[model samples]
Target: MQSWQKVQCGVLLSISIAVMAGCSASSPYRDRAEDYRHAEPSHYELPPIPGQRDQMPIPQGSTQGYTGDEFIAPRPESMQTGVAERPPVELRKDNQGPWLWVNTGPAKVWPALQRFAEEKNLDVVYTNPRSGELMVRADVGGTPAQRFSLRQGVGRQTSEVRIVSMSSGQALPFSEFDRERMMALEQYLLVTQQQQNGRVSLAAQNLDDGDQVRWVDRDGRRLLVLDFAFDRSWGELQNLLSNGFDEDAQRLDDQDRSQGIFYIHYLARAERDSGFWSWLFGSDNADKAKAYRLVLTPSGDMTELHVEDASGQPADIQVEQELLDWIRRQLT
Candidate 1:
């Protein structure tokens, strides 16, 4: 009976302790909160420090100065807010490569670039990261002043522009791409120049026929090359080469010493018609600038005949066979 009474007493004591703890937590005051009733804010709210059991001292008057902010605890860093800048690379990356990267400002890069220009035969007039003047070497000799510029892209991109002045008073800007294109364009210029030179060289051979004409590609045997100009008559050319030339030369010599022209006749069919030979071989001053030639070749005999001019002069030329052989030797 005694133990049961003690156990009942113990149980009641535990209940009493719990109820007292709950009451204390629920109460808005610890002791004598009524004494500070004068200090109570008319529009009271809890401070950041929590329950506000502690009142911060304030001036006796001026309720407006005592904002709720006055009693708050210091703010945590995460709570602070404002615009923030992007972090520096040094701060962002834990470890950088061994060598430090410094900007080596545009001023420093200029000298090295200047040295580079000099070696390239370009004069370093003045350079900045932007625009400047430079002297560039010319093909003939010496150097001439030129314009230069540097351009940058949105990112850290860079480019160079060079302007060259030719003897003609115009400036041409050369980009990186222009230099590459010139390699192919220059080849075209070379080929055209060579063709013009070849046509000039072939000019001498145009007036004669093969066998009697100059054979540039000939071997030991005599050869002639003939060209028919689009404007001239091919029949006249044929007759002149066949027998008209020798006949005209002889006729002119026999006619008279006083008359400049002499005529000759080849009695090809025996019609006594020298007029046919004369008509084809004789020159009319209207076509004086025009004439056709033929080259006739036999190893032992080569005789080519050029026609007479409108002045009645004899058609006379002595083209040798050995000249053909000599030209052929050169080709090989």
Candidate 2:
């Protein structure tokens, strides 16, 4: 009995020790809860209600009454000065094409061209503003002749003056006189367009036409004009030539966009079919690839493209035309 009592006492002591250890472990959480419960409120204040004063006192003086009409501020001095300092309208000429483009519409250009004819002392044979056409007759070097056509260009806000010389009511081919007359008219109209200012007419802003490629004659040479920036035109030409040549036989040999030159390889079809061994062993009959150079020149807002052989000689007219036609189709 004595031994069992002793054992029971020992068990009770162990239980009390374990409970004390557990309480010590959980004391931190109880301390945290008590700290939160005793914390003071924050110091923030709510905003005052609109249209109701809480602290400010009313003024003692009499307030002014509102006028029936609202006060309107005057226009800024800068705006008035800007109107006086406005720059004159300037026209841009296409180097390859016989046309000029302006920001104003055809209505403005029509009157300007008419005024030009009057100033030149040319007889206005016919004038049609609706169709954007004008004809003027003048005597040049003792021969009575008429300018065949002076018309608005296909693009919006663009106009062209065709200087086709006519004698005895027959239209002649483009001549040196025609070229000089065209240049003179262009200069006169450019100056005239700059001086005039009025209400601009409403016309379709045909932005897409700015990118279309066209063929034009410049100094008796047929040149291809692309209405694109130089960088964009260069990239398009690279892709066009890359995909245009025979895939397996021909490839782009080299290109320099800054210099506006592209070198292309034209390998014979038979060379492509020959085995790798033939190429490695230097077969006597293996055909060599021919190289061609493409040159691009920027003319105002347009880029002109021309082709030549490896020897730096201009490509045959038919060859150049055919290549340009193919590129036009691809671009379209």
Candidate 2 steric clashes: 0
Task: For residues 190-303, write the lDDT of model 2, one tens digit per residue.
Answer: 576666765333332222234367877654345678876676577657655655554433456788877999887544333334558866865533246567777899888778
C-alpha TM-score for every candidate: 0.19, 0.33
Model 2 misplaced regions, further than 4 Å: 1-104, 138-141, 148-155, 199-332
Error of 2 at 138 (Å): 4.2
Backbone clash tally (model 1): 18
For residue 248, model 2's alpha carbon misses the true position, in angstroms, by: 25
